[model samples]
Target chain A: MTEKIVIGLDGTDTGERALAFAKDLASKIDACELLAVYVIEWSPFTFQTAEENERRHNRREEEINLAMSRIVDPAVEGLKAAGFKATGLVRHGDVAETLNKLTVENGGTQIIVGRASSDGFAKRIFGSSTQNLVMHADVPVTVVA
Target chain B: MKNFVKFGLTAAAVTVMSSPLAAQETPGIDERVNEAFAAVTGPFVSLIFAPFPGTEFPWIVMWLVVAATVFTIYFGFVQFRFFKHAIHLVKGDYADPNDAGEVSHFQALTTALSGTVGLGNIAGVAVAVGIGGPGATFWMILAGLLGMASKFTECTLGVKYRNEYPDGTVSGGPMYYISKGFKELGIPGGGFLAILFSIFCILGALGGGNMFQANQAHAQISGIVGDYPGWITGIIFAVVVFAVIVGGIKSIANVTEKVVPFMGILYVGAALVILIVNYDMIGWAFSQIFVGAFTGLGVAGGFVGALIQGFKRAAFSNEAGVGSAAIAHSAVKTKEPITEGFVSLLEPLIDTVVICTMTALVIVISQQLIVDPATGNYLLNEAGTAISTVDGNTGVSLTSAAFGASISWFPYVLAVAVVLFAFSTMISWSYYGLKAWTYLFGEGKTSELTFKIIFCVFIVIGAAASLGPVIDFSDAAIFAMAVVNIFCLYFLMRVVKKELSSYATRLDAGEIKRFSH
Candidate 1:
């Protein structure tokens, strides 16, 4: 049976480190696949005007396209060029939940993400995605420093 | 900077045009302008408000009531049956994460609510109770309840018949549904009714949506500051409004969307405070509303007058059956159009049954209306308007006085809220009017700009004009929308019924997915 690892990408240097760690871990094991996922943070609770609401569908589409092109695509391409089996996914939702859901659906054995250095006030009040994933993931969550 | 320069130039031009009237002392330019407007619009206004033959009630009010009743019965009280589901939809419990669009049920409902819950709730309720007596409140609540079904019907059609462009933007309203639904049914004259509905929507957007908001906003501001030329207020409002709509200032529109909802909560919170403080009078106020609803409490025209005022204000406030809210709700992201229909029923409940009732209760509890001890009827001045304790203050002023009597600082907060409400309503209506404009003239940059400019100019006119002609014309234009919209709704309600039963069967069969616990 192939071991599947889900790597969360933020299009940042920290995220690249997490990818490198996940690739290193996958190489030691035969028949391993990497699933790169990018989640755009969105909340349905935000209020919008009529005009804004009208344009929101298009805006969401634009956000998804930008994420796939700029973040998920590059990571997946690099993994493929390195002769590793990899695929990319982009979605709009809370970051931790989307990543966890992707892992479960894809039968990923482990989840990997980078530790973001900035712990802002909001993140403290509402735990960071990494913190949430570490606490709640069904599979083991590997946090790369 | 370019937008600012353009806005500054327009404001300067408007100020220059209005200065002559401000400088002149003869009858004042405000009165002269109002008189000219009244003269032109008088016949149309009278025709719209014309009483039914051998009856004092305006046929338009009855038309709305009857349509609401029909929809309520036809849908088997869909508003009541699915009301709990509506709340769940808004809470996103039934939301599919993979829905094609981005707008949630909550956002759609809030956007529609913001448009309907404006000056109509603040001032319109005062006018209802003031003229129709406390009994009007009873009828107003009933109209709100029945109107929910009308919203469900129109909004279902709004989503089902919506025109989704290749670019992903959608447009839907009475015009789209009337034409498309009628064509589907092989009905003739759908084209004519669609065109007529679009025309009425544009006029209603300009009159009730634009001018009435501007006029009442000026009234509130002038009440706070000392009396000044209304054109001054008009020009300032016109400039800000012009900047948002014409100049494409999304920042202003964004701020307004966020702030207005907060203000709505603040206004309601203050009303709750006042209601709690006047807890002792709550029973008396409700009893007055009940008795006045039946007896008219000696109000002129008795029970019929209360019924007329209640129906008229509820239609104006909740905008159910008016077809404007359908436009707002149509953009919601849902494959099942009936889901949006269910969500929309909550609009009238919030706008009229809850918020408007709060305003009415506050006015009654404040003891603002002077009741003659001998006759038990409200004291009427020479002009026959009810003499309130606040020197016959009407509209927002009367409402402000009622709140102020309980919370002294409330009137100040209310003044700010009123201005914000006016600005937000104007912005929303500009979009509705522009939709109708584009529907008629075809979509293009120049056509859009022309309508925006005309809309801004009307804001100035709305602010400058007196209450009489502005209110009359506004009422006429809005009811005119109901005339076309409700007629089409009768034809399209079966479509909604089919959708509702399909949705219900799916839910009962466990086909509908619930995303959250």
Candidate 2:
């Protein structure tokens, strides 16, 4: 079985690019699955009621589902439409922690991310979290600019 | 458009020439750095204790770390208790848009972060990791967390002691806090302490905050741009910084308030993408940092013992007691002193906890560590010797190379980030130094103009020169501020307690509410 390719999305513009790349790669590989993972962060203070909290949780889940539907599902559906196997996965926690965890849990072999075109002063004091992960990830990380 | 075209053309040329250039290259970059560092690493390793003094231990770092810790403990870890409140202060429950201050809590926070978060996070960590090891990250985080308390103390004092000009512009910082806050506390030594801190702040403004920031940036740009001496960086930076800084704090803050957030989001967002793509490495990163903190292999045979590397870096990262953040915090618009203190908590959280953590993790897990650890002893590219000192580029380049190992094109990403980080920091520090300059040199036209001229000139020198000596003195001055400021906090901290208790009472009464949804 060919390995799977996963594209992690944080609902940013670059994430959309990563999703497209993952879908194309899934098709190029003889046998591959595409998994979409999202990590949801919830502050313990925000929810005062269980019923309300349940509604909120469900709302967040739906939001992730919709995002997946837009960014990942279209790509996944496109792969399927092209006769390839692809899936979606989403989780929740701190961004770095969640993404790292999801990549390990999912059977993802190679992961893809994005970089920026402008390398101005903004990139300096504040580093690119995606770039940091790609640099240090144990697995093969392909960064798509 | 021309530069863009030129950049593209040049990039292509470098790629095409990489092989031939490598084969026929004659090296001239044999300038040595960290000489004191080398002395410490060799015969001085035992009695001298640390791997290097200023490069590693430096009395300034020692003082800053000590003060930050003392403030954290004395304040009863208030940084944690008031974390939410700090968030709200920026949300501005009490923020009057009609206030006389130059910026709001959020703008103030961003401006200050621009100053505190600079090349230090990148190269400073690299240096600490180079000398101290991965363990340095553990300390850096600890320092950043505790540094929040120090930040709180200084910022509260900043608001407590700030001044308003006749025309209604704001002038504040550690000078006001020390000279003024101390007097309000009925301390006899208030004037002296304020003056001392002002001196330190002035030194810090010029050295660490301004010059050091510009110096490292110049090194990085020149480092990557190739064949160009660092001076070219100085020339460009001098022009840009001089033009902007001459406009004073209003101009500086206006640009920073916008620039800081966008850059912060951009950099952190990029780091997130990298982490997600390389998610598996996260576990190993945590393991190494957690373990490295306990072992001495990171720094290897330091008299101070294990994890000093971590402490040194942490101390550098958060800059809790250094008093630089206070200058920015002083400008916050509020009558209630504690409001700005709450907002100040985010400094270490963003600069130290979030940003520094990401950089540390990246460096730790990079394949480069597979080759050398602790930013330990430089390896000469040609002869492969373990030299104590390296070319200036080694500090930042080490980090870039580690990042590039995973993302082949990541060096450019980091380079862009490095330049921005340095640029924002330079601007922020410029404000800090200006405040100090005005404090010492009588806030007149000539004082402002003269200080500015020198500051701009330093920028060029910083960019063009080798960073070794420039950074050393600047680093020293920053530490000195921490020493003086922490002493005042120790004596006058009861005032902070009263303020905190009163604020807590209001919070309990539900008088303090979030500003908006």
Candidate 3:
């Protein structure tokens, strides 16, 4: 039976590095299915205008497309080209929360994600998803530096 | 989460109750603030809203009326023709599952509606009716109908020239369109107009959107709970507003979208119930409106006063030509900009024609004001306006009196509605002000934060201060925005015309396909 591994992709070089490390680990394991998941951190609890709410469905679709094209696709392609079986998902939610749910749904045994990609002021003020996943994730989480 | 919010609110209520009972007596500061504001705004108010020679009409009112009339002719009355399509678009019939915008046609319209549909529909309408007589209702509807065309034109340009950032966010409104559209047409001074509009928007946002809402909310609260220091209500409002705004733009939109709809339904539903209950009087009330509109029904300002007041209130309430709706509409997701424009035209119609008229009908049907049976004219005070139901009065108090007359318990419900309406308007205007602020100062964390902090401070000031100067300045700022925005619209309207024509042609050819999903 293949061991399912969930990898978070953020459309950054750091994300690519995490995927590469995950790919290496999957090869070491006899049978493994790589699940590349990209989350477009959306908060249902957050405020929105009537306009934003009306277009919420369409915006959700766009966000998914944004995640798939900009983050998940490249990671999936890289894994597939490296001769591994892989699947991709684009979701709208809190990044850490969504990734954990995706892992449980996909029956993933472990999660691999990159370190915080940006050291910008915003990220500093609002902590990174990697830290959140590490603390709250049900499964084992590997943070690639 | 829900329990937490409930608990938090209970705590807040407790704090408000336990904290103060002594300050209401010394309203001296409030008086001084009012006087100071009155002084500052006094001259500008007269200058900006000066009546035209030989008429009671303000020149600013003429500016909007002329623009609305012109757009109506130029677009060949697109408001009527595309009215059906606009409704369809709002229903999400024409929306592609994969559109490029942030909000839907309906959401944009509703969001903008929340901003315009607030105090104006309630308090402003009462003011207009109280002064212009029942006849003002007729002129208001006319202005609203014509204003639809103006809304359509500006909103179309808003989407057409909107700046879509790489992060999938959008910046738009008169600022973007005036600058970008003019540049496209090889017209200079677009930058000048853009800056001017941004300045007015920021000022308007601070004054009308922030202070006025806070002041009104404080008044409502004081009416319910014996007066506290206005600053207390101001501080509370400022704190909540700050929290919501800090959560970002999505948070502001989310709250307004929900609260505005609920409040609108509550207020309008109450009005409908009153109207239905007084079915027999509805016809008589409307006849008064019609008669009063034409002959002024012996009210002061005669026929023209009613017309001017009605038009002014409608323009203020719906904001059709003020161009602020364009900012909200620009966020709508659509491949064709004109579709959003079509959707936007309904804003004024709903806000002014439907909602304002509902308010007017209720006020008229209440029989609270003294009316002469022989001439159907309201008994006027020395100043020549319909006498208030309450002594020394005007604004929402009069509306409250009317509603309270019909339903004894309604004043309590109305106080709640007033607070919610004021809150929603403040949050929405915060966004409008923020956008204009960013346009001038540039977008960054510090810049954004600075504007927001300033906004929060103004909320406190608005709540604490007297209504005179704060409201006057805000009114002037808002009208000033219209002055700059409408001026630019006149020049860039040809571009809007071209876009509308092309969009219409495409619609006729069935080239714009509706996505089933």
Candidate 4:
């Protein structure tokens, strides 16, 4: 069975670094498939009006399409061009929790994600998802700085 | 829609014109306004609180208690059966990664909690025990327990019938469920009921939710800073609440979703400390509660009185069958509507069962009531019950006196808590009021602005108005909401039952996937 390497991407320069690291690791391993996942943290706990709630389902579909076409597909195409068997997934949830759930469901052997670019007060208070993935992910997680 | 707007404007004009005259005629604006409000609200107050024929109890309390009991049995006590699952759902254990919502179960729960867990828990509990004695605490807990089932039923329907928009937003509550659920069942009166419910909800939002909050906050401030004109407090509250709510529901929800949890912990933690300090009195407190509940031991109106106060306060505190929480819980992200229902059971549990009970315990153990130790009876006043430690006090002041007994400076901390609690409740109710407003008038910028403007005006009105008619009218409006909402619940709860059983079957068979340990 081929080993699975899951790379978490956030459509940032750091995400490219994570992909590059995954590519390098895939080459070292004899047979491995690459799965790139990008998570959009959409909170369901928001308060919305009837008009807003009416449009929520359509808006969510648009977001997923936008993420897939504009973000995930382009990145996956890049990985494929770079001589790797790569697939991309777009999900809406907490970054770390979504990534871990995806990896476990997909039977990934290891995971790689980029460190958040901005280490400001907001990130300090909210905490970096990369750190969260490291602590909570079922699989071994590699955080690329 | 135009007519409604016109009526609102006329009412506003009357208030605005009267304010100047009242202020000019009487230097004491607060007293004058209170008198005017009392004059206006007196009849409505009597009508709402009128006792049932051949009974001393208000019919509305029986209405709520009976509805809660029926729901508990109809659902087979899902509150207990799914208690663990509800906790797991709140933790997002079964959440699908692709679910479309703006917040998690915990956030939704906290936001709903913020709305219900307000002045009712603090001042309302004190009033219950003050009148009904420690026995009221026992009945309050019982009512809270039964209320959990009502919360479970309405919230499930809230999510099930909620309208999910294309813009990643959601709107739900009794308005949607009554209309949609009734339509699904081929019922004819769904539209009328929805309209009626929306009207009551708007009134409730304005009266009980917004105005009452402003009124209470002003009262607390007056306790600390000498009596000032209420409009001053009202204007200040209006400005602050407007600032928060005008930012939209997300801004309102974000604040509540954060503040409510922290406040719950802080408030409950303080109560726990008091209970622990009075460790020796813990058993005695429970005995007093149990005895008071049955025999009305030294309490006014005896067992019936204790039972009435308990049920009334619990209904007021948790708002289980009121359908307001359905609006908040409807935004939860889950394909399984029953999961939101399960999570929502925690709302009444936290609000009435745990928090209200804690408040009652602290008051009971504080020995603040004028009880005669020699006879284990209350020192009765001319009205029959023991007088409050604080003269002429009914609500928060009584609770403050209770806490001030052990924690000398607790009243100061309580003042801050009251402001925050009032603020949180105001914002939450604004969202609720806004939803009902938009529902009736049709959703638009103009209509939305018009409703919000009226709501802000009520904040000022609530603060400046005397406690008599304003509070009574709002309380009546809040209970009036139940008349319509609980009626709908009778028809729609079977839908919730179906959803719950299906969810349960899937879970028991291990068909539900767990994403995390």
RMSD of candidates 1 onward, in order:
2.2, 18.3, 10.0, 4.6
Encode model 2's per-residue lDDT on B18-55: one tens digit a residue.
33224334432213223432332243223313334455
Clashes of 2: 32
Residue B410 deviation, candidate 2, in Å? 2.8
Instruction: Flag regions of model 1 displaced more than 4 Å.
Output: A117-119, B1-27
How well does candidate 3 match the true structure, expressed as C-alpha RMSD? 10.0
Model 2, residue B487: displacement in angstroms?
1.4
Query: What's the true lDDT of residue B290 in model 2?
Result: 64
Distance (Å) between predicted and true CA of B411, model 2?
2.3
**For this target, which candidate reaches the highest lDDT against the unseen true structure?**
1
lDDT of each residue in B12-111, candidate 1, tens digit only: 5465446544555765777777888899889989998999999999989999999999999998998899988998999999988766238999999999
Lowest-lDDT window of 10 residues in candidate 4 chain B? B13-22
* Poorly placed runs, candidate 4 (over 4 Å): A1-4, A23-33, A41-71, A93-97, A107-109, A115-145, B1-26, B100-103, B247-253, B373-375, B381-386, B390-392, B514-517
lDDT of 3 at A79: 92
Q: By TM-score, how accurate is candidate 4?
A: 0.88
Instruction: Using TM-score, give the best candidate's number.
Output: 1
**Which stretch of 10 consecutive residues in model 3 chain A shows the poorest summed lDDT?**
A43-52
lDDT of 3 at B26: 60
Tens-place lDDT digits, model 3, residues B281-322: 999999989988999877777998888889888887888888
